[model samples]
Structure formats: structure tokens, C-alpha cells
Target: MLEGTEAVLAAQLRRLLPHLDERQRRLVMGAAAGVLGRGGIRVVARAAGVVESTVSRGAGELDRGPELSGRVRAVGAGRKRLVEADPGLIPALLALVEPDQRGDPESPLRWTVKSTRNWPPS
Candidate 1:
């Protein structure tokens, strides 16, 4: 299930449908499933009978949220980031680690160089 912020986000997305073209509106509804914890773009697009790029674009726009309220949506391939999609994590992550010892046991997950994929299994 989606958290409160996500539910609000999904609601906001549904509210934006009236402003979109038919194709874009279909894309927005597809992307909203992922926002509501239904699934990712692949599944959403498949369910909506639309192209993955369409859903991807809609998800990208939703990510921008109300910040782009009056702006026109841009057309392009979106960039994939190395980090998870949650926007509230940066300060939490930075607060949890020091500059030099980030790879140390300070991380709650305790991931380490010793746990590197190439390390021989015991």
C-alpha cells in the first residue's frame, strides 16, 4: 500500500487528467498505479495498453509534482538515477554517514568492503 504522501501524489495526478491530452491522460493513469503501489512502469503500461515510454514520461512528470504546475511537460528520454526514487532520503542518508567512513559499519544495513560481491564465500 502507498504511504500518505504517495496517496496524495496519486490523487494530485488524477486531478491533472483534465489538463492532459487523451494519450497523456492514459499515460498518467498508468503511471499512477506504480505511485499507488500497484507496480512499476512495465506492468502499468501493459495494463493500460500503452507504450512504456508513455508511462515513463507520465511517471517522470508526476515526480516533478506541483513544482511544474504551470510549466509545459518536456519530451525526452528520462535519466535513471543510481539511487532509489524516494525524494526524502538524501538528508537522512547524509546524516547517517561521515565523509570518510561511509563504507564502515555505520550504515544501518552494515554493508561493507568485506561484503563485496567479488569476495570469496566462506
Candidate 2:
């Protein structure tokens, strides 16, 4: 009966993935995995195509109650912005956009005109 329930839950999660946001999906998977008890992380992770760590974190969140806001991902979640990830990125962009230097000819933005208001503040 447990195996049958796991299979059913896995199928439901797979079908629901496209419609639900990351947090919602994780919650559903975590809840289902929690119901299965022991070894549920591995089972649900395989079924959901997510890592065990993700399911583990989801389980942790479930235990902690509603901590997240309206957003799908938690605050400061996902990849860091390019500027934050690479200190050199802003300098490289500045060098390209500054006067007296030719920007990358291959860049699609090279042909497009942009207003100063649209540019990021230095």
C-alpha cells in the first residue's frame, strides 16, 4: 500500500510541476515524502528530478512552518546577480559603454540605441 501510494504521489507531483511554483512543488513533494516516512527523501527526489538536499531542505522548511513570503523562492535564493557574482562585470560593462572605445561588434546591443536613463547608475 505504501509503494502504491508513493507511485500515485510521484505521478501527481510530475503532472503538477509545470503548474506550481518551486516552493509549492517542494512543499507538495516534502509533504508526500513525510507521509512515507523513512527513506522518503530518496524516493521523492528521484521521482521529482530534484536532489535529495532540495527535498531535505523542503522537509526542514515544512517542519519550521510558513517562513517564506509570497515569492516562490526564499529571499536571496537562486543564483546571484552577475554584478554580485563577478566584481569585474561592472568594470567590463563600463569599459564597453564609455566613450572613445569601440564595444563588441558581435554584441546585439551594439546596433541598438539606449537612453542614459535606461543605463544602470554608476
Candidate 3:
């Protein structure tokens, strides 16, 4: 369990994690854990729901100071874009939501009201 400021920091980290890229999250967690000093790895790992080794790697990266071309995440680390993953997705969506023969000349789903309830589960 965390105590006082550590708890607050952990909560803030949790809130910010989704908005951050993987490396950023790791770096932030590692830095905060560093501030906590000894036993910080275990504390931060538990709070962040990440393995201790991950936090340790982040700490190492922090100490190393962007030697790897200042890149946050390594090359080709994230999920591919939707268009790349599914070439036909745009055409299918256009066909479904196109308003007329022009077929969304300006934009697809521009005038259409879309809701989660109307979307089919993939």
C-alpha cells in the first residue's frame, strides 16, 4: 500500500497513464519511483500495475538520458493505424454511411448521427 504523497502520486499516474504513450508512462513512473528512493521499484511497480523489471528498465532509461536518438518508444513499437491494418474498412464504412450518390463527397458521417448502439460489433 502507498502512503500520503505516494498515494496521491500513484493516483495521478493512474489518471495520466491512458493519455500518455508507453515510454512516457514508464518514464514518469520511473522518475516518481526514483524520488521515493529505496524500495521505490516495488512500490511503483505495484501501484502502476507493471512488472518491477519494466520500472527498472525505465529507471535505467532515465539515467541513460536519451542516448537512443531521444526516442520515447523504440521504432515500430505501437499498434499499426486502422487503415494500414484493414484496407477495406474505409470503403465499407463509406458505403454504410454515405448519404447519397455523391457518397460523402465532402465527408462521410458528416451529416449522419452515429451512436455506439448502432455500430455492429466487429
Provide TM-scores for the models: 0.33, 0.60, 0.55
Runs off by more than 4 Å, candidate 1 = 1-27, 36-39, 67-122
Tell me how far the alpha carbon of residue 118 in candidate 1 is from the true structure, in angstroms, after superposition: 82
Check candidate 1 and list the clashing pairs.
Answer: none
Candidate 3 collision pairs: none
Give lDDT for model 3.
Answer: 0.79
Candidate achieving the largest lDDT: 3
lDDT of each: 0.58, 0.78, 0.79
Candidate 2, residue 104: the lDDT equals 82
What lDDT tens digits, residue by residue, belong to model 1 across residues 13-87? 556766887546755665565555645666555545557787777676666664444434445425555365666
Tens digits of per-residue lDDT for model 3, 1-122: 34576577669878989998778877888897898899888888887888998889889889988665767767897789999999999999868766534435665435555556966646
Q: Model 3 reaches what TM-score against the true structure?
A: 0.55
Best by TM-score: 2
